[model samples]
Each structure stands twice: as structure tokens, then as C-alpha cells.
Target chain A: MSELRTRMSAAIGTAPVEATRRGAERLAELRRRAETDYPPMGEMRDLARAIRLHTLANLHRYLSEFCESAQRAGTRVHLAADAAEANSIVESILRAAGARTVVKSKSMLTEEIGLNHALDGFRVTETDLGEFIVQIAGDRPSHIIAPVMHRTRQEIGRLFADVLGVAYTDDPPQLNDIARSHLRRRFLEADAGITGANFAVASTGSVVLVTNEGNGRMCTSLPPVHIALVGIERLVPSPAELAVLLEVLARSATGQRLSVYTTVVTGPRRPDEEDGPVETHVVLVDNGRSRVLASEDAEILACIRCGACLNVCPVYREVGGHAYGGVYPGPVGAVLQPALGVGSADLPFASSLCGACREACPVRIDIPRLLVGLRHRLVDRSSFSWLGLGLEAYSRVASNPTAWRLFLSLGSFGLRTAARDGWIGRLPFHASAWTAHRDLPGPGAPPFRVWWRNRNR
Target chain B: MSRLSEFLARIGTARLPSARPEVRAPQLDATDLVSLFIRRLEEVDGVVHRTDPVEVVAGLARRLGTDRYLSWDPDRLPVPGLVAELETLGIERHTGPGREEVPLGVTGADAGLAESGTVVLIAGPGRPRHPSLLPEVHVALLRVDLLHRSLTHWMLEHPQALSEGSGLIMITGPSRTADIEQQLNLGVHGPREVHVVLVGA
Candidate 1:
């Protein structure tokens, strides 16, 4: 908790956070647009969830079928049990293709598997403009959709000038055009392209990629060899279901009715097609997803990665994506990171359990409930902690009415020095850690039980 | 165990509740398809030629600075005498390959979606993916009869429409991005201008 608070405190004021605030604005607009665009939003979310549940339950069958169909479509399918295997496979494919340089579209799966770090010998450039900025600035993505959302234009301009030896300017068009001209050369010269799938259909061996910049299209088309590393869980049944997912994905992510580009790449180029890649390889990566699938909190596997939960989460907006300290951040990240690593147990506690993430989630994963579950598991798995003991005693006291009333009255008297005008300016004990950042409301009135007794009199 | 076998062993074939919940998403509320298609198309900064004779394309072409023209098969073109008009306009037309140097590209879409104003492109003979992609200006000739109501309608009726090709795309708006500080820009890689000429069947 001290570590998280220090990191979050360090992020304050120095970070512009305009992008995250705009992202939150974007999410509210998404809800309105979804209501307008998809019409019956509630029914659509329910149906989307049902589809995900059915697919996850029959995951093995669907996965086997997907492999078969992809093989039939002339795509070589490779399975990775862990990140090392996935990285080695990617490297092997590049080596076989004799690829020295690779252009990549933004893919969280690659980030999850730590692919960029593993590709030590090869030259890899992130093709998306925001990703390119982060790559040059030597930073990881702070937001999923807009990676450099936390940085100021002035900062980015300085990075570009220092790295690329260009004139410094904060103009968006100039920066975009700078990235455009620079990446165009890379696209033409790179030997292989790597991307992540928004959805992979089992019935048909097609990979659906949705992007606004059309960089995904460039990465797939301009290169000679294409490799798509997909998390095993991002699969649905068919194109019919792909339509349903796309409907929510666009509105939920950027508030667009549909993104500018929704591409379906079946496989490598056909016998006579002039463009597209000559060879296609799909790496089915299951670093920790299979573990997630088998766990009790398996419903989280249904996420579409629309990032709506992150955008609307108040905790996420203030502290920003970096505070969570995981490949995936925000509410989904908090629930998801613990399943991957024991070290990430602190992530789940990062949420306020506000239920906003659950409300915003298109699939309705019940994120707050999962965070509570993670808290419970933390107690059984790890050693003694003050939170566990405090919560344990508090719950016991909370259930007993007589004990609870007495506890509240004693708390008011104990907090009188910090109390003024119904708010606590500071708190005593280690609990003052909370007040170090934000003020807490004082025990303003008498206990409800006493107030009720006085009213009756 | 092989990873697949290990995974299969861990994950048994448990039949979840059947997912056929009747979620009715009926978005084809527009009785008039052309107006709806044009309205949706225009909303996305796409130009639609709905007037008679399809000569309205000539006006749309005026803005594009058509120095050289590269298009799909001449047989598939819905704009009557378009090639002759290009010749008369002193524009050089080249039809060779992908990654060409032409500025204006013309092609025929297999279908146009009305709900989202998307053009569905399926690759085939004379449709060498480049005409719609590599050029700065993309002018697709759409036959009115080929416009579909929505993705749902297309999926139920023609599920194999996209799967049969090496690549299939449903391009809605022009190639764009808001990647730099969330400021929208057009023509990052694909065609900057997307104009559709809707001709009578």
C-alpha cells in the first residue's frame, strides 16, 4: 500500500492527464452513442456475454476446430504453453523468413508476453503513431488505445527532436506527419509484420483486426511474412457473432459507430492475389490464459478489450494507467493481473470497488466481485497483513448491531481533534496514510441507532 | 504432454447453457435504402453520387486532381463512358499492379453496407487490392442493387462472402488516425478520399 501510494503521489500534477480525462469523456460519449447506435444496449450486452460464456465452456473444441480450419486455410498454427515458447516461435519465424526488421501494430498480447524485450537482436518498430512516440521516448503504453495519452505535446516534441533529429514542434499534424513519413519507409522495407487479433473465428479461419489508423492494414499487407500472436481466449464462434462484438467494440472504445477499418485476413495471399503477405503464421499463446480458464474467476476470459472499464473508472482516471503497474491496467487489469503473477496481488486492491467498471463492461464480468474474491484469496495464500486482520475484525463487528453502534460512537470521540465542519483534516495512527493524499469525512453525526432512539423520544 | 493435449486435459468439454437467447437487433428501420445509404455514407465524410447518369463523379473527380487513373476491370465499371471521360479530362489511366504511382484509384465494391456506410471488397480478377489501397484518391463505383442493409443481414445471408478471399475489408471512412494527441488526421496510409458513385441497376 505504501509503494502504491508513493507511485500514485509521484504521478500527480507532473502528469498532464488531458488524454485520460478525454478518454473518460470518450467513454461517456460511448454510452450515449451505444444507446443510439446499438439501440437496445442492455440486450446486446446480455447476448454478448452469453456468447462468450458458451464459447469459453467449449473452448477446447472450438480451439481444435480453429486450428483445423486455419490449417485448411493454409495458415500454420503454433501453440505456446508459455511466454518463452511464444517468443522463441516468433523469433524462429522471423529467422526462417530471414527477417531483420519487423513493423508491429499495437498489441497488448505481445506486451503481455514481453515479446519486444525478447526480440533483442531484431529491429522492431511500432507502426502506430502513439506507439512510435512511446518507443522513441523509452516508455511503455499508459493507455491501451492511446498509448502516449499521459505525455504533453511539448514532451513528445522534445523526444522526437532528440531521438529522430527533427525540429521540435508540438503541432499534432506535424508530429503525425513526421511519424507518417518515417513509418512509410519502414513499412516498405520491413521483412515481417506482427499484429494481434481483435477476434478469431473458429468456424472460419479468419482473423479480424479493427483499427482507426489503418496501420494494421499496412503491417499485414506491405510485409512479406505476417505473424499474428493471439491470446487463446479471444475467440468466438463465427462471423455472425463477430458482428455483435464489433458493434459494441467501436462504440465502447472510441464512441464511433464502427472504426475506420475492420479487416478480415483469412490467410496468406492466394494463388493470384497481387497484394498481402506471402506466408502467414498464427501463434496461439496461452501464457496464463489456460490457468485463467480453469480458475473459479474464469468469467474474466470473456473480455473484448474495448477499454470501456478503464475509461470510466475514477481510480484509473486520477492515478492513470501507469499506477496499476501491469501490462493490462484499470479494472480489468486489477482483476486479471493477480491470476498471472503472485507479485501482482497489490493490483486488485487498487480499485475502490466502486462498481463503475462492472457497469461499463460490455460483457458484465462483475469486476468488483472478482476484486473482493482476490482479496479473500490473498488472505488464504499470503502471510499476515493489517488489512486482513482489520477487515476480519470489522466484519465481525459490522454484523453485530450492538458492537457496531458502540464502535461508531467510540470512533467519533477518538477522531475529535481531526474533526471540524464534518470532515477529517488529518487522522492519527497509521490510518493517517489515507489523509496524506486525500481528506476523509469525519464521523459527523451520532450513530444512527442513537439518532433513531432520540427521534423516538 | 503436448501443450494442446495438456490444455485439453485441463479443460474438459463442459457444455455451457445453449446460447441461443433471442437477442433481436433489428436495425433495418429504413424503408428507403438509397437515402439511408447515402446519409450514412455522407456522415462518414464519404461522397455519394446518387443523381442520374452517374456523371456527378466527374464533379467529385475535379477536387481529387486526377492526373493519372488506375482502376479495376473495365467490364465491372458501373460509370458508363468513365474511361472516355478520363481520357477527355487529359488524365492518364494505368492498370498494372499493386503499389503503383497513380494518385486516383477506381474500383467496384462487391457490396456496400447502408447501416455503417461501409464498402465490402472481395479480391478477384482485375481487382488487384492495390487500386483501393495504394492510391491517394479512391473512387468506388457501386451498383445500387449491391447495397446491403447491415452486417447482420450480410452474415445471415452470405456468411462465406468474406472468408473465400485472401483478404476482405469493410472500409467505412477514409484512412484516418487520432494517434498524436488525439487529433484526427486523414490519409495516413490508405486512400485519403473515399468517393462512391452509386449507379442505377
Candidate 2:
């Protein structure tokens, strides 16, 4: 592992406890906000759902319209069926532009595809404050929204002072100034810039970048060539629809009026302009998103990249972003990563089915329902053994109440015999991982159905 | 060959039929509309000012240090005499003169939509889309009467707006990003500063 990755992993290993506390506190705060201040999140979530549903149902029409409009606006758009293709196309563009050093804005798609790692042959710099911190440290982002949420200010001060040859200070202003100074030179020196798109307007061929800092502007404009990596589903039919999404995104994510800056870039700079990038190319990455889109559980695409779900998820709140073992984390990641990565059964089991994620979603994605659908997909997999066998056996006994009762009664007798005090200390096989964390409750002596039948009689 | 065509194929493959959806749409009001637009800008450390459009430009000019600027429109000032008053400060107007040479860029607004706190600029005849983006400073003139509470409202108001093949920029604030080491930097690529001058009749 690279020094950064190792440090990140070590730091991540220690984060579960701290993250557990912070995540719990954040969840409580959010719940309190939901109850007292923003009581209408559930309602707003529904409206977001309706808007996304309308867009997705007729995605073809909207996407084509967006492309036509974007093309007319003078943007060259490339679609990649997966991450590799997306990276390849982007790399090719960078090479053609004669770019050696690239300054980038925070883009999860780039993280997912390991774009920076692929650019190891060249110099690639991350400009988003959170992304930049993690980039210099050579660590993967720990949080979807706040990549350096795992690190304390002291740790960051050390990292910057050590790596960038700047004075070390835990103070935010001092830190901010140092970062600004370091990046200013890169912005001027870079030959190309890369960013992730918040939304792409099919009707106007405009890419909307919502940010707090102004780095995205530099990354897009400072270089001669600008490239954007956007998910395929990030398209809204018109700027009007795009505007609605921008409104809800900030409020739900950070409770702000708007991000510090919102820039709508259409194609490249015109001949008369002095500063903006001369070339603009947008890479629309499918990267298994298209596969999920085709599935009956396609609502996952409606995600606006808001991290609200992670803040509220009981499991995510406990383990943090690193434990999810992917670029995305939390309820959204539990569903998205497996769908986007590989059709693996182990990934979907990451959720606890608490439905807190769905409750917090601005776009009102029924994450629990999708998670259940993923379980079915996993079960259908040819490699699925234990779950498939268990469910298949369950169907036979479940058909008859009498048979089910007998089977449960017999199983209860055996479990009780095996029980130590009130709990089963450990299981011999697949169930062992569960007991590692918490004890499993022993089955009661008398079966509930039998006791209820006797009492009623 | 086109990204759109490839995107279409991906979309075609991902389309699945829905059985039933349990969620319902929520009722929206005007306050929700206002809050939504204001909220996105505020989170990223942006400021929102509500004032007469004429005062808006003057206020922004004061913040930017000088009244001298180059604008796309000939009749940009809310009152015809306002530009003449500022003209002593070298507030030169440009039809398509070299925009790169100007420190401040002033352009007429196409529409000021309230949905995203965005002032839309439609680059029509004589204006190249690039000038609006490349300047160190950009000052947009947004008409207050043109402000709509919702993006849908704005779209309905201008049905052929996006299809006009003109450059339409929905600028919320100065160009910015937090990508490098997550530190916020201003004036990186596009304009270092963006001030919207809201003009009212």
C-alpha cells in the first residue's frame, strides 16, 4: 500500500469508535431538527421523489434533449459505459491536451474509478478542501460530502506542514490561507482541469457546479482543457428543473441558503474571452449505473449525491465511510456500491433495514425497498449458497402452519439445550460474525403459537 | 460515436418497469420556494441581498473598488443617465470590444430566476459567450421584475430560451471550488468576483 493508503486505513480503523459517537450525535441533531425546525423533510422528500420519478420514467427523452441542447451550446460530450472506459476517454483527452499536471475538483466518479491513481504517470492535484486534504495524505475520502471528516484539525495541520513545507497551525484561517497559496500556483501552472458535475442540463448543455470555495471555477477555467466526469442520471431536462434540484440539495445537505458559489458552464470559453478554459469535454460515466437503472430497483439513480442518508444511517453512523469499503458509504453506498461494483451478495447485507435513510433522503428514495430488492438479486446469483438454501427450505415449511410450528418447536428445543444462560455465546459457522459484536437471544422454551393456541382453547 | 448515443444505449438497458410506488408528492408554497433558492447559496458561505435592481449594481460597484467597467449592453443602466454619471469613472460600454482587456464585465440579464438565485445571461448578437466567462470580474444586470419564485415558472416564461442557441449562463456567485486540499480559493478559473446588479423599473 502507498504511505497515504496505509495511514488512511490505520486512521480509518480507529475512526469507527469516534465516528460512532459523532454519527450518533449528528443523527440526534438531525432528528431534533426534523422534529422542531424542519418538520416537513418527509414532505419535501416526497416532492423530490416525484420530480425524480418524472425525470427517470422518461429519461431517454430528457437525456436526448439535454444532449441536443448541450451540443448546440458547443460542448463535446462523451459517454462511457463503465468506469474504465470513462477513465480511458478522460486520459486520452488529457494526453491530447498535452497536460502533465491536472488540478481537480471533488468528483466521486473519479474516486470510484481510481482516476488519480490511473494518472500516476502524470501529476494530478485535488482542489476541493476536503478532497485536497485527503489527496495530499494519499487517502481515499472517508465521507461522501466531507472527505476529511475523519481527521482532526491538529492532524491536518501536521500533514500540510510536513507535505507542503508550510507552517503548521490548527487554526482554520491559517490553514485556509496556506491551502489557498499552494493551490494558486497550481491553478496557473496546470494544463488541464477536471471536476464532477452536480447536474447536466440536457436542454441547454450546461454543467452545474455547486461549491462553497471558488476552486471549481479555477479548475474549470484556468486550464486550456476542462473535463467533467458526470454520472449518466445527473441530467435534468431544462435549467428550470436544474434550478429546483439546486434549491433542495443545499438545504437538505448542509441547511444553507446556497453553496458559496454556483457556476453554470456551457461548453468552452469563446474566442473573445480571456480567462476560461479553451476546451471543455464532458464524460458521462455509466460505470454500472446503467445496469442499476435497468433493474426494477432503479430509483437509486435519483440520488443527488447528498450525504443526509449517511448522517442518519445507524450502521453508517457507527462505522463511518471507510468501513463501507467503497467510494460511497452509508445507506446509499450499501445499495449503490454493490450495484456499481460487482453483483455480490455480501455488500447489500451492510444495511440494518431501519429506514432512517429513506426518512432523511431529500429525493425520497425508498432505500430499504431497494436494499430488499438487492437481497433478492444476491439470492438469485449462482454463487449464493447459504441464503438461497435457507430461503428455499423456508418456503417448504412456511406453506403449512402446522409444519412450521412443529419445525420451530423442535428447533427451539435444540437451541434451548445449546443456550448458555440467556444467550447463545457463539455459532459454529456463518452466524459467527454476528456474535462477534453482540450476543444472540436464546429461543424461548414454549413456542408462541402453541402457547397462544392452548390459552385460547 | 456521440456521448448522447452511448448514454441512450445505457439508459435503454437500465430501464425497468415499475410495479408500485408508495411515496406521495408534497404540497409546495411560496416560502418553500424562497427558502430553497436562498439555502443553496447560503450553505457555501454566500450572502443574499434583496434591494432595488438599480441600487444592486451601485452597491456591487462600491464593493468592487471602482465604477469603471465594460458591459455588453449599451442601455444597461436602469435609468439612461446612470451610465453617463458613471462614465466619468471610465465605465465604457462594449458591443464586442476586447473583453480580456477589461477588469470588470457588465452584461444585461436575460432573466433573474428566484429558484436558484441565478441571473441568466442570453448571449445574442455581437456578444461572444466566452467574454462573460473569462473576465477577472463579472457584473450582471438582473431585472427585479423578471424574478420568478420557481425554475418551472422561469422555464414556462421563456419556452424557447435554451433552444435559442445563445449562451445562457445561470451564475449564482463568483466562480469557486474547494477541491485542492479542500481549501476555498477565489478567482481560480472564471471570474475572481461575480456581482449581480438587480435592476428594477
Candidate 3:
């Protein structure tokens, strides 16, 4: 078995299936609500897709334009070619500012680059409730939106009790209060704030953040210095373009017309401004995105990190996000990880190709087509594989009428011998793997070809 | 080439489409925008008070059972003499940095989006970000004329709203999170209750 298979099996064995199911169900409910609430859902999605594609196709122009405008607006823009470069740039920024404690909102880009691990000496705290829980537990986030989706309330309650020295209670609101009180102090005292941009408007040189909890606002406003790790692809030409994307983002992510807070930071605080970060740095991290853009699956960049595909995905619903073995999980992750050059080769084949992801995708990314295309690329690259050999053998037999008839007869006879009550409960060797999960129907006695001939006669 | 130039070079240009797609503003009949805005705001757990800003503020303070509150400077507010009204009502207005133990926050909105029940707030010197942020409860004084149909419409109309301030935030509802077992809990780090006092509605 591959490493991904081993991790998936382990996750399936240990991760609570009930919690994941409930999370998926809740996401489905929210998605349905969002679709119903936004009557122009389809039209907005088309506009969003067009905007994303246009931005990507003309990324060079927009990126340069954004950097110039950001600089003009008093934002120091840094371009990092890879994860290491990005992490180092952030570290140097912190070091220069003499920042001791850092409060951060939920930023997948920071996770992808492993920022916390790099900032070992500095007191880094995740301010977002979900991310804070993940920080305390010393665990990886299972879901993109709801990081602790796999964790139960009781588990979190105990984690707070053990870590924060608070009394145990599974009540969500009470738990929220505890985090609010604890992190509020961190927000006040923290030397710097770090965040990820949902979209960067090139024209005005602004970073857009969408969040329901308002932690995004807290992170951007409370700290003296702010650093935003933005993926190169997270850009729109103007607020007009941003408006279109924002319309669909929350609805697609959590089924809200708008998140509780949608903040647009143009730059560091103005001299006359009483509050907000005095120093702002927008680090544009490439981190294999250019590689992805060069690949056949470039459309994956169009994703807004909504995680809608994860909710509707049947496979993800079964095994949960940990099984995908990456920062991003579910259908988007399957294509994205490999495209980013960080995933197992079998990641593409992990899907059922139901096209539910494509359907759920607000950007209308053809995920199924991308998965198939990746599989094709994998096959072409590999020298040998059981799948390739099996296909080669089947093709030779299938092309010749006599060989095809003999192969079918042999397969039918073998299946017939194994059948009990006209159902093959188990089969010997590798075929038993299929029967282990579900029973297979025995081949008919007259066979389909013979039955067709008889019916015609 | 510099690092930025090198990075940009990696992302080579593609054939551009002749025309970019345009996003249409949400259709809202002029007569019903205020009512529609109220309903949408209510749906998101925000309270909408249709009355004079002064009475709304006084009522909200009384309802919350608090005498002291934080707010934007008087001149920045849409309603004239709001501070005087609060003072007359014996509502103590707290000012200066550090909003500790403040129960309610009042401010003026830049614009009100009817489609999503959103209030756009721009950060400035007198207009601190935390009055609406750090407090447990927040109230905004929005004039009827500032209301727009949607974010798209608002952006199309007020392009300079993006560049005029250091930052702008569009608040739809109170702060909420569904992180714990996908069970939503309000007021995680920001205000739990958001009230929009629509003046001259």
C-alpha cells in the first residue's frame, strides 16, 4: 500500500466518523441555504469564474500593478518564490520589528509554509477560535473552513481544561467565552498580527479578508505591525471584480450572503488614524503556484478556498479530510496537492469522478476533468504499473472477437463457480478485495450476447 | 531581474478576452429598499430600529441595561447632537484608547447595503475601529440616503471609498463561529449583538 493509503486507513480507524458526518451535513444545510438565499447564484458564479480566469490569465500584469499600487499606498510588498523564502521573509520582518508575541487569524498560506513551526522562539498564537483550538491540541486541521470538524465538543472542552486550566464544559457558547477572554488579552498584548488575504484588489492595492468571527478584523487592526501572506493567485483587478467574488465566497463557503466581516485593508494605518497596523507588509508567495499555473490543471487556482466541494464529496464524507494527507483536502486538494507537487501519486485516483465537486465549485472548476487529466499524465510518466499492464492485456483481448468471447466465457465460468445463491460473496486472490465490501452478481448462464441472439430469433 | 520581476516573468501572459464580464447590481425596487434591508438585517440576527437615531440609541442603551457606551466622535456621527442626546439621557460616553468593560459601541456607517444587510465602516482618526469591534454589543447610526442595493452597486457608485481610508470593513451581522462541532456560537471575539439605527427611514 502507498503512504497515502496507510495514513487514510489510520485516519478512518481513529477519526470519529460521526463528527465528520455531522459536519458534512451542517455544511450541506448551509450550502442549500446559501443557494436559496442568493437567487442569482448561477449568474454570480459565472461572473466569479470569469473574473478569476481573467485575473489568472493576466496575472503578470495584475501582480505588477498590485505591487506598485501597494507600495504607493505605503504597503511594502515582497515576492517570495517558494515556501522557505516566504517563511524567511516573515521571520526577518518579525525580527526587524522586535516582535515578541504574534496573534494570527486563520491563514491556509501560513499553514502551507509552516510559519508557526519556523517562528519557534516567538510566542505565536492563533486567534481564530478553530485555529486556536488546533494550536492548543498540537493537531493538524482536518477541514479547511472548520479546522476542528473531526473533534467533538467534549474533546475541545477537555483540551481547554487541560491547556488553559479552565473547568471542563462541552457547552459551545461558554467555550466561546473562554476563548474570547483568553485570546482578547493576546490580541491586546501581541506585537504583530498575521493573516491571509481572501482577495487582493490590484487597482487600489488592498487586501480583502472575509470571516464570520471577526478575528480577521482583530488581527489586522489590533497589532502595530501586520503581515499578510497572500498566494499569487489571490488577486482581482478592482473592487468591482472583488464585489463579484465576495458575493459568491461566503455563500459558497458557509451559505451566508456575506460573512460577518468583510474587511479591505488598503495599507498600513494612515498617520492621522488612531488605530490599525502602523507597518503593513504584503508577502506574495508563489510556492509552486507558478508550477500549478503552468500545468494542465491551472484552473484549480480559480478555487476561492470555499471548501464546498469537501462537504458534497461522498468520498470525503466517508473518510474525512485527514485521509487526503495535505493542508487542503477533499476534491480540491486531490488535484491541488499534486499540481502543487506535494501529494502522493494516487491522490487523483482517490475520487469517484461523480463531478459533484465541479457542481459545488463556485468557480466551476472542472475537477473531474482535471483528475482524469492528472491520471493520464501519471500513466504517461510511469514506466510500469499493474493498471497499465491490465489495460494493455484487456485491449489485446477486447480488439479480437474470438479472444474477447473466450475471455468473457472464462470470467463468467470463474464467477459462476464462486457464486452462492446467485451472488459471489467472496472470491480468491485480489478480486476478494471488491467482495470484501460488497457482493457481486454472478454472470448469467446464457450470457448477454446469447440472450440477445435468442431474443432476436 | 529583481525577485518581483522574476516572479512575474514566470507567470507569462495569455490571450486576453476582448471584453471582461460585468456584474449586475441586485434588483431592488426603490420603495421597498428600507424594508428589504430591515428584513435581511433581521435574518442575520442583526436588530434594526426604525426611528430617530437619538431615541434608537437611548432605547438600545436602556434595553441593554447599560448607562455607559463607546462611540465615534460626535461630529463623525450622521445624527447631529447624538452625544448631547446620550448625555441628556444620563448615558455616559467613554472615550480614549482601550475599550475595557464597554458593553455597547455606537458609530456612523459610511453606507448601508440593502441586499445583504451590510454596513460599510471606514477607519479614521476619530472613527476608531474598535468601538464597533471590541464591545460586546454594537450599534450603528445609518441615514436612509446612504443605503445601496448591494456590494456591487456600492462599489460601482463609490469607487473612492476603497482608497480614501486606510481600511474599510463591511459588517453584515455580529461576530459568529461554527468551529466547535459546526455549532455556531456568536460573539467569539467581536460584538455578539449588532444594531443598525436607520435615521429618517
Candidate 4:
């Protein structure tokens, strides 16, 4: 079996069914509410797509503008060419500040770069409730938006009991209170906080963060030092463009007109300010984004990490996110993983090409087209394979009428003999791969050409 | 080459599509913005109270059921004589950060977005981010005139609002989460209850 298939089967076998059902229901409810709340949703998506594409096409100009404006606003901006460089720069920042305890809001970029592992000696706590639970349980987040979507309340109740020495209870609000009291203390005492930017406005030199929970605000506001790990592609030209993207992001992500908190942090706190971080650092991590920018699949960079595609994906619904085995999951992950050169070659073929993701995407990414393009690229890269040989031979025969007719007749004969009650329950040898999952339809007794000839008689 | 230059050079200048898309703001009844704001805010689990400025402040203090609360500086609030009103109600206000035990936190909003029922709060010397964040219940005092149709409308009118402070936050409702078994839970990390007092209404 392929590695993807194995992981998928394992995920399907183990993932709590009730949790997945509940998560899907909630997502459906949100999507329904979003349609009513935002009346001009289609126009908003077009505007968002245009803004993202324009930003990427002119990234250098905007990035330079962003760095200069950020510096002038008292934010220290660092440029990292890769993950190693990004991690080292963050380490130095923490080292200089003598920060020992760090609280982090949900940042997939940090997870991508493995920032926590680099800070071996320092105490790092994931402050977001979902992320906090994922941290203490020593697990990777399964979903982009809702990290612990696969875990049940009962399991979380047990995790809290086991990890925090608290009594076990399956009620969600009580569990939330326990985490709230615990993380609140960490928020007040943590030396530093790190978060990811949803959108970084180039004109104002501000990092925009959207979150339903206020942990994003808590992390950026309370700590003495704040570090934001931003992907280079996260830049928007100005607040006007930022507004367009924000209009679609929350609605697409969780079906809200806006998240509970949408924060825009321009720089460190002023000398007279009583709250907010004393020092702010913005790390622009390019980790292979330029390569993606110069590729045919550059539009994948326009994705806002909304996970709307995942909610509507049939394949993701069946196997869940952990099967994809990447920081990003679902249809977007299939294209993005290979685009970033981090995923297996088979990731692109993990979809049914349903076109649901394209419809659901707020930025209107043509994910199906990108998936097919990646599949073509993967086939071109391979020098020799059974699939390649078979396709080459099949194409030659398909072009020749006589050979095509002969091959179809032979195939029909073999399929007709194997049919039991007009259904091929199982086939012999390598063809059984299809029968293993589903029965194949029996071919007609007379081939299509023969039937055509007989029809005229 | 510097790191920034190297990064920029790799993202080389290529002739790219440059058509900027324009977004048309939805038509809204300007005279009825206050009602729109109230309804939108209520949709997201936020409370709206319509009362005169001074009466509202006193009412909030009295209903808080606690002596001490966090707040932004009185002079920055929309209502005049807020400090006197709170004093009359005997409510002790902590303007600085680090008072986590305070049950209520009150502040004046920079602007209120009618489209999403969002209140924009900018952080500055006298206006800290804590009052709106740290307490169990957050009460925002918004003037009727400060309400705008949406985020885009507000940005187009007040572009410099982004540059005025170290940070600005648009809070639509109270802090909430649905991470545990996808069940909705309020007040995970921030205030559970958010109340907006329309001063001029």
C-alpha cells in the first residue's frame, strides 16, 4: 500500500466518529450563516483574489515598502531565506532579551519551522485553547483552523485530568475555564509571546491577526517582547486592501462577519504606553515561497488559510487531516505541499477532483486545475514507471483505429467472462486493485464498434 | 548581499498582471446606522444598552456588583465627567494593566463598525489594551456618530487610524471558542461578556 493510503486508513480507523460529525455539522452551520450575513459574497471574493494576486505579483515592491515602514514604526524586521535562518534569528532575539518563558498564539508557520524544538531550554506554552490542549497532549494539530477537531470532549477531560492533576469532567465550558485560568497566569508571567499574522499591511507596517478567542490579543499585548513569524506572502499593500481580505477571511474560515478579535499591531509600545510589548520583531520567512512564486501554481500562494476547502472536501471528510501528513491539510495542502517541495509526489493525486474546494474558496483559487497541473508535473519528472509505460503504450494504440478496436474487443471479452450477474465482483491479478475497493461494471457483450455496426444492419 | 536584498532579488522583477480590483461598499441607510449597529452586535452574542451617557456609566457601575474595575483614562472616554460618575457610584477604576481580578473593564471606542457590530479600540498612552481584554466583562462606550457602515468604509475615511497607536483591535463580540468537540464555549481566554453602551442613543 502507498504511504498515504496506509496513513489514511489508520486515521479513519482511529479518529473519533462523533467528534468528526460534530465538527462537520458546526462547519456546515457556519457556512450557512455566512451566506446570509455577507450578501455580496461573490464580489468580495473577486476583490480578495485580485488583491492577493496583485500583492504576490508585486511582492518585492510591497515587501520592501513593508520593511521600511515597519522599521520607521519602531519594529525590527528580519528577513529569513529559509527555515533554519528564520529559527536562528528568532533564537537570537529571545537570547538577547533573556526570555525564558514564552507564550505562543496559534501560528502554523512556527509549526512548519519547528520553532519549539529549537528553543530546547526555554519554556514554551501554546496559549490558544485548542493549541494548548494539543501541546500538553504532545500531538500535532489535525486541522488548520480548529486544531483539536479530532479529539472528543471526554478525551480532553481525561487529558486535563492526567496532565494538570485536575478532576475529570466531560463538560466543555468547565474544561474551557480550567484552561482559561491556567493560561491566564502564563499570559501575565510569560517573558515573551510569538504569533502569526493573518495579514500584514505594507502601507501602515501593521500585522493583522484574526481570532475568535482573545489569545492573539493576550499574546501580543501582555508580553514584554513580541515576535511575529510572517510568511513573505502574507503582505497586503495597504489597509484598504487589508479590509477587503478581512471581509472574506472570517466569513470563509468560520462563517462570521468578523472574528471576535481582529488586531492590527504596528510596532512596539510607545514609551508613554502602559500596556503592550516593549519590543516588537517581525520575521519575514521566505522558506521556499519564491520558488512557488516562480511556478505555474503560484496562485496557491493566494490562499488565506481559511480551511473552507477542507470543510467541503469529500476526501478530507473520509480520512481527516492527519492522513495528509503535513502542517497544511485538505485540498489546499495537496497542492501547497508539493508547491513548497515538502510533500510526497502522491499528495496531488489524493483528491477526487470534485471542484468543491474551488466553489468554497473565498479567494477563488482554482484548486482542481492546480491539482491536475501538479499531477502532470509529477508524471513528467518520473523517468520510468508502470503508469508511464502503460500510458505511452495506450496512447499509441488509441491513435490507431485497428489497434484500438482489437484492444477494446480483447478487453471486453476478458471483462464479459469475469462478470457475475453483470458485475465484476473481483478480477484476477493487478486489476484486483480496483475490485478491492469497489466492484467494476461489466462491459457489453458486443464491443461499442461492433454494436454500432450491428445497429445499422 | 544583505539578507533583504537577497530575498528581493530571488523574487525577481517579472512583468506580472497588475489590475487592482475595486470593492463597492454596500448601500446602507445612514440615518438608521445606530439600529443596524445594535442588531449586528446582538447577532454575535454581544449586548447593546441604549441610555444617556452619564446614566449609562452610572448604571454600568451599579450593575457591575464589584467596587473595582479596569478602564481607560476618563478624559479619553466619550462621556464627559465619567470619572465623577464612577466616583459617585463608588467604583474604583484601575487604568493601568495587571488587574486580572477586576470583573468589569470599560473603555471608549475609537469607532464602531455597523456592518459587523465591531468596536475599534486603539492602544495609546492613556488608552491601554488591557481594559478591553483582561476583565471578565468588557463594556465599551461608543458614540452614535462614530459608527460606520463597515471596515472598508471606516478605513477609507480614517486611514491614519492604523498609524496613530502601536496597535488597534476591532472586537465584534466576546471571546469564544468551539475547539472541544466543536461545542461553543465563551470566555476561553478573554472576557466572556461584551456590552456596548451607545452613549448618544
| Model 4 steric clash pairs | none
By DockQ, the candidates rank as 4, 3, 1, 2
All candidates' chain B TM-scores are 0.81, 0.67, 0.90, 0.89
Question: Each prediction's interface RMSD?
Answer: 2.4, 5.7, 1.8, 1.5
Give one digit per residue, the lDDT tens place, for model 3 in B12-39: 5444332467767765446577988899
Predicted complexes: DockQ each: 0.53, 0.23, 0.68, 0.72
Range of the 10 consecutive residues with the lowest summed lDDT in candidate 3 chain B: B12-21
Question: Mind giving the per-residue lDDT tens digits that candidate 2 earns over A168-210?
Answer: 7987657766776687678778999899998888767888787
Candidate 1 per-residue lDDT, tens place, A348-374, comes to 778889898898888888999888998
Q: Is candidate 1 or candidate 4 better by DockQ?
A: 4
Residue runs of model 4 more than 4 Å from their true location after superposition: A395-409, A416-423, A440-456, B13-16, B27-31, B53-64, B95-98
Q: Candidate 3, which segments miss by more than 4 Å at Cα?
A: A10-15, A416-423, A441-457, B14-19, B27-31, B63-66
Q: Report lDDT per candidate.
A: 0.79, 0.68, 0.89, 0.88
Which segments of candidate 1 are over 4 A away from where they belong? A383-427, A434-457, B1-3, B10-28, B51-66, B76-81, B95-100
Candidate 4 per-residue C-alpha lDDT over A1-457 given as tens digits, one digit per residue, 9 for 90 to 100: 7898888777774656346646855785697689776667777788888899988889989999999999999999998989999999999999999999999999999998899988878999998899999999998887889999999889999999999999999999999999999999999999999999999989989998998999999999999999999999999998888887898898888888889999899999998888999999999998988989988888999999998898888888888878898799899999999999996779999999999999989899999999999999888888888987888999999999999888887888888989999999999889888899999989866667778999999
Who wins the DockQ comparison?
Answer: 4
Cα distance off (Å), candidate 2, residue A74:
2.1
Q: What are the clashing pairs of model 1?
A: none
Tens-digit lDDT string for candidate 2 (B1-201): 544565586675445332223332223455653445455444433344456534555555666665555655455333455565566545445444444455666676677655446666655444444445555677665556766654546765675776453234556666554333334556544566666544553
